[model samples]
Target: MDGLDVLADETALLLASVESLDIEDLAHPSNLPDWTRGHVLAHIAGNAEGLGRRARSMSDAVPRSMYESLESRSGDIAWRSRRTVAQHAQALASTQADFAYDLAGIPADRAGDDMEIRLGLMVRIGDLPLLRLQEICVHHADLGVSTYDWSNWPPALVAWMLPRITASFAAREGFPVGWVEVEGARISVGPDPTTGVSGGATEVVAWLVGRAPGSGLAVTGVDAVPVPPAWL
Candidate 1:
C-alpha cells in the first residue's frame, strides 16, 4: 500500500490499542524516559493537531509552525495529559480525524510540491504521509504496552526508513562512519566502511531509533554494535 493507506491503517490500529487502556494504565511508565503512557497519548493527539494544521497551511499556500516553540510543545502535552484515559482516547481519535479531513482535498499531483515543514525543513508534500506513518509506528512501539516490537513493523517501512535515518546520522558531525547491511542491502554512509553492523531491516531501524539493545545484529570491527548517535 502507499504511505497514506499505510498511515490510515496504522492510525486505526493505534486508536484501538489506546482505547483498550484504562485510567490506571495512563499512569504507568512508557519506554520513553521520564514519560508516562499519559504523555504518549497526549503527544500523539497534539501531533495530529499540529500536523493537520500544517497540512491545512500547505493547501492554502501559507506557512505555519508545527509548534510555537519546544517549551510550548512540552507544556501542551503535559497540560493535555492531565485528563483521564478515556479523554485522551477521545482526543486522539478526534485530532486524527481532523488530520484526515485536512489532507483529503490535497491533489495527488500537488503532493510532490516542495514545502517547508517542521523545524524549517523542506520536503515534498508527499513525504508528510510517510512522516505520519513513521510517528505512529514508532510511538506505538514506544508505548511498550504489549507484544509490540520491531518485529511487528511492516518490512516495507523498515526498508524505506533505514536508509533515510542512517543518512541523517551520517550527516551529523562526530557520527561514526560505517556501512550497514540490512537484509542484504548494503548501505554505506560515509567515506569508508570503518565499522559495520549487519541485521534485518527491522532490527537496524530499531537500533537506529534507540528501540533495540543491538543483541540481534552481527557486528564487525567493533566489540559490539555501537549505540547509534541520536538522529531524531
Candidate 2:
C-alpha cells in the first residue's frame, strides 16, 4: 500500500469531521469518557505535530524525542483543546501536511532505521505513516459526531491492523485465551484455548481493540464475551 497516500486520505476525512463541529459541539462529550470533542480534536492535532517532528529528525539524522515528557504531552493537549474551531482545524491541516512532506523526504536507506518512540519502545522510520493512519482512523470514530464507526474503517487498514492488535492484546496479562473467528477464518489467540469469539472482521477488530462492544459477535464456551483491556 502507498501509506502516505492512504494517510492523506484519512487525514482529510478526519479534518472534515472536525470542521463540521461548532463551538458548542466541541464542548460536548465524546464517546471516550471524560474527553470533550475539543479534547479529541486537540489530541489529533498534537499527535500529528509530534509525528511530524519525528519525521523531520529522521530526515536530518538528528534524533529527537517524540514528546519531551508524558506530562508535557498532556499539558499541550489540554491547552490546545480550548482553541476555536478554526485554530483546531488549521493545526490539524498544517501538522499533517508537514508530516507527509517530512515522511516522503526520508532517505531511502534510512527507512529501515529504528527510532525510539517511548522509553523502551522503538519503531522503524518507514512505519510512521501507518502508525499515524491508525491514530487518525480510530480517533475519528471516537469523536462520535457522525454515523461513522468501526464498520466504516477501510478494509485494507482493518486487515493490516487486526492481527497486529490481536497479537498485542493476547500478550497482555489476564487476556482471555481463545480462538477468534472472523468471516470463517479462525485464528488461535492464545495457547490451549477453551473459548472463542466470532464476528465480521470489522466488528471483531473493533471489539478486540476496545473500540466497540460485542454487539454483533457471538461467544462460545464462555458465559459472556471477553472484553479486552484498553489498547495503548
Candidate 3:
C-alpha cells in the first residue's frame, strides 16, 4: 500500500487499540516521561484535532506554533481523560473519524509531495507524512498500547530513515549509542548485527524518539559516536 493508505491503517488501528483500554488504564504511566497513559491518549486526540485543523487549513498561513500550544489544549484533554475509558473511546472515535476523513480528502499528490510544512519547531511535513505517521505509531507504543512496530513500518522508510537516525546521533552531543545501518529488514551497527531488542529500525526509531528501542538491535553496538534520535 501507499503512504496515505498506510496512514489510514495506522490511524484506525491506533484508535481501536486505545479504545480497548479501560479509562482507569489511562492513569497508568507510559514510557514517555511524566506522561500518564491518559496524557498520551489525550495527546493523540489533541494531535488529531491539531492535524485536522492544519490539513483543512493548508490554504491558510496558520503558524504551526498554534498547534504547538499544547498547554492550552491539555486542560481539555486532561479533563476529558478523567471520564470513563468508554468516554475517552468515544472522543477518540470521534476525532479519529474526522481525521481519517480529513487525511483521506487530501489529494494524493499533495499528501506525498516533497514540500515541507512546518508542523512544529522540530517537525516538517514531507514525504507522505512520514513523521506524522511515525508519531502515531511511536506514541502507540509509548502509551503502552501494542499494535505495530518498526516491523510493520515500511522497509523503504526504514532504509531512508536509518542513515538519518545514525547521522543525527553523530551530530548530537550526549544522546548516547552509535552508528547504524539498515540492510533490508535488518539493522547493523559497525561489524556486529542486531541482538534481541526490537529490530534496528524499531530500535533506531525508538532511540531517536527518546523511547526504548523495541527489538532486533544490539544495545552494545556503540563503539563510536553518540546515538541520535531518528528524526525525519
Candidate 4:
C-alpha cells in the first residue's frame, strides 16, 4: 500500500470529524477512560508532532528523540487538551501536514533506517506513515463520534492492520489463550486454542484492540469472550 496516500486520506477524514464538532462538544467524555474529546484531540496532535520529529531524525547526523520523556509527553497532552476548539483544530491540521512533509522527504533507500520513539523504542522510518495513520484513525473513533466509529474504519486499513494487531494483543502480558476466528482464518492468539472468538474481521480487530465492545460475536470454551489486554 502507498502508506502516505492512505495516511493523507485517513487524516482528511479525521480532520472533518474534528471540524464537525462544536466548541462545547470538546469537553464531552470520549470512549477512552477519563479522557475528554479534547484530550484525544490533543494526543493526536502531539502524536503527529512526535512522529514528525522521528521522520526528520532519520536524515539528521544527530538523531532526536520522539519525545523528551514520557512524563513530558503526558504533561503536554494534559496542557494542550485545555485549548479552545479552534486552537485544537489548527494544531491538528498543522502537525499532520508537517508530519506528512517530513515523512515524504525521506529517501526510499533510508526507509529501513531506525529512529527512537517514546520510551527508547525504535521504529523504521518508512513505518511512520502507517503509525500516524493508525493514530489518527483510532483516535478519531475515540472521539466517541457515532458517525466515525470503529465500524467506519477503512476496509484497507483493517486488512492491513488485523494480523499485526492480533499479534500485538497476543504478546500482551495478560491476553487470553485462544484463537480469533475471522473469515475462516483462525489465528492463534496464545498458547492454547480451547477458546475461540469468531466474528467479522473488523469487529474482531476492534474488540481485540479495545476499540469496541465485542457484541454479535460467537464465543466457545468460555461463558463470555475474554477482554484482551490494552494494545498500547
Candidate 5:
C-alpha cells in the first residue's frame, strides 16, 4: 500500500483507540509534558482542520495561512478541551475525513505548489500528508495507552521516515554530527560524523524525536549518546 493508504489505516486505529477511551480518561496526562489526552486530541483535530483549509486554498489557488497564530491555536485547543471524550473523538474523526476529502482533489503534479505552514515557512503542498501522518503516528503513542508503542509503527512508515528524519537532524545547527545505525542500516549525519550510535529502528526514531531515552542504544567513540532536541 502507498503511504497515504497506510496513513488511513493507522488513523483508523487511532480513532478506534480514542473511541474506546472512557470519558474520564480524557483528563489523564499524555506523554507530552503538561498536556492531557484531551489536549492532544484537540490539537490533532485542529491540525486536521488547519491542513484541510490549506488544501482547499491550494486547490482553488486562494491564499490563506495554515495557522492564524500560536496564541489562537492554543486558545482553540483550549476551547475544544472542554468537550467530552466522545465529542473529541467525533471531532477528530470528522476532521480527519475532511482532510482526506480535501487532499483527494490535489493531484501529485500540483502538490509541489508552494504554501505556507504554521511557522511561516513555505513548503510543498505535497508535504502536508506526510506531516499529518507523522502527527497521528507519534501522538497515538503519546496517548500513553498500552496498545501503542514505537514498535507498533508501520514498517513502511519507519523505513520512509528514517532517512528524512536523519537528514533533518544532519541539517540542524549544532547537531552532534554522527553516524546512527538502526538495525544494520547506517546513516551518516552532519559534516564530520565521527561517533556512532546503534540501536533498533524503533528506538532510533523515538530517540531522534525526543520521545525516548537513548538507554537502549549502543554508543561508540563518545562518552554518551546525546539526546536530540524535540523535532520541529
Candidate 6:
C-alpha cells in the first residue's frame, strides 16, 4: 500500500481519537508543553483540513502560492487555533467528510502524476499521502497516544523524523543544550548530538516535546518549565 492508504488509516485513527475525547479529558493538559486535549484535536483537525485542501488543489491543477510565505502559514495556524474548541472539532469532521467525498472525484491513479507544486517544485502527487502521514503521526504522538507501540509505527516515519525531532530539540527556544536519550541511542542535543541512543525512545521523545520521561511529561530537568495547559 502507498501513503494514501496510510493516510486513510491514520485519518480514521485520528477521527476515533477525537471522538473519544471527553470534555473533561479535553480540558486536561496533553503531553505537549502548552496544549490541552481539546487543543490537540483542534490542531489535528485543522491540519487535516489544510492538507486536504492542498491535495485537492493539486488534483485540480490549481496553483497554490500562499504557502510560499512562512508568515502566511503562521497566520493561518493562529487563525485556526483561535476558533472555539467545539468549532475546531466540527471543522475536523467537516474536512474529513469533504476529503472522503472528493477522493472519489479524482482518479486514484492520477495521484502519482507529478507537476509543479509548492514553490514550483515538481513532486509526485503520491508524495502528498506521505506528507499527510507526517502530519497525522506527529500530531498523534503529540497527543501521547501510546496504545500504538513504537514497533508498530511506520519505519518510514521513524527514519524521516529522527533527525527532525533531534533538530527541534536542539533549536527549541534556541537553547540548543541538554542531552537527549532515545531508544538505545543518545543524541546530545545541547553540547553535542552524537550521544547516540540511551534508554526508552518514547520517554526521550516525550521529554524532548516538553514532557517527562514517563506518562504525560510534566517537568523538564535543570530548568523546570511549567508547561502551559494549552500545548495540545
Off by over 4 Å in 3: 60-68, 104-128, 146-178, 184-199, 213-216, 219-232
Candidate 1 residue lDDT tens string, 85-111: 778878978888898888775677887
How high is the lDDT of residue 124 in model 3?
Answer: 33
For 119-162, candidate 2 gives per-residue lDDT tens digits of 75566777788778888888888898665677788876788788
Q: What tens digits encode model 4's per-residue C-alpha lDDT throughout 1-232? A: 1477888888888878888888789999998899999999999999988887877766565577778888898899999988887898899999988887877777788877776676645556667777777788888989998679888777767886788777776765556757889899998787677888999988988898898779878897888877877777
The residue-by-residue lDDT of candidate 6 on 73-183, one tens digit each, is 655655565565456567777876675554545567886687444554444665555655666666666666556433344666555455556765465443333454555
| TM value for model 4 | 0.92
If scored against the real structure, what TM-score would every candidate get? 0.93, 0.92, 0.68, 0.92, 0.90, 0.55
Model 3: lDDT to the true structure: 0.58
Colliding residue pairs in candidate 4 = none
Q: Give the TM-score of candidate 1.
A: 0.93
Q: Mark the regions of model 4 whose C-alpha exceeds 4 Å error after superposition.
A: 113-116, 120-122
Comparison by lDDT, 3 against 5, better one = 5
Root-mean-square deviation per candidate: 1.7, 1.8, 5.2, 1.9, 2.2, 6.9
**Which candidate do you rate higher for lDDT, 2 or 3?**
2
- Leading candidate by TM-score: 1
lDDT of 4 at 208: 81
Candidate 1 residue pairs in clash (backbone atoms < 3 Å): none
lDDT of 5: 0.81
Per model, how many backbone clashes are there? Answer: 0, 0, 12, 0, 0, 18
Clashes of 1: 0
Per-model C-alpha lDDT, please?
Answer: 0.79, 0.81, 0.58, 0.81, 0.81, 0.56
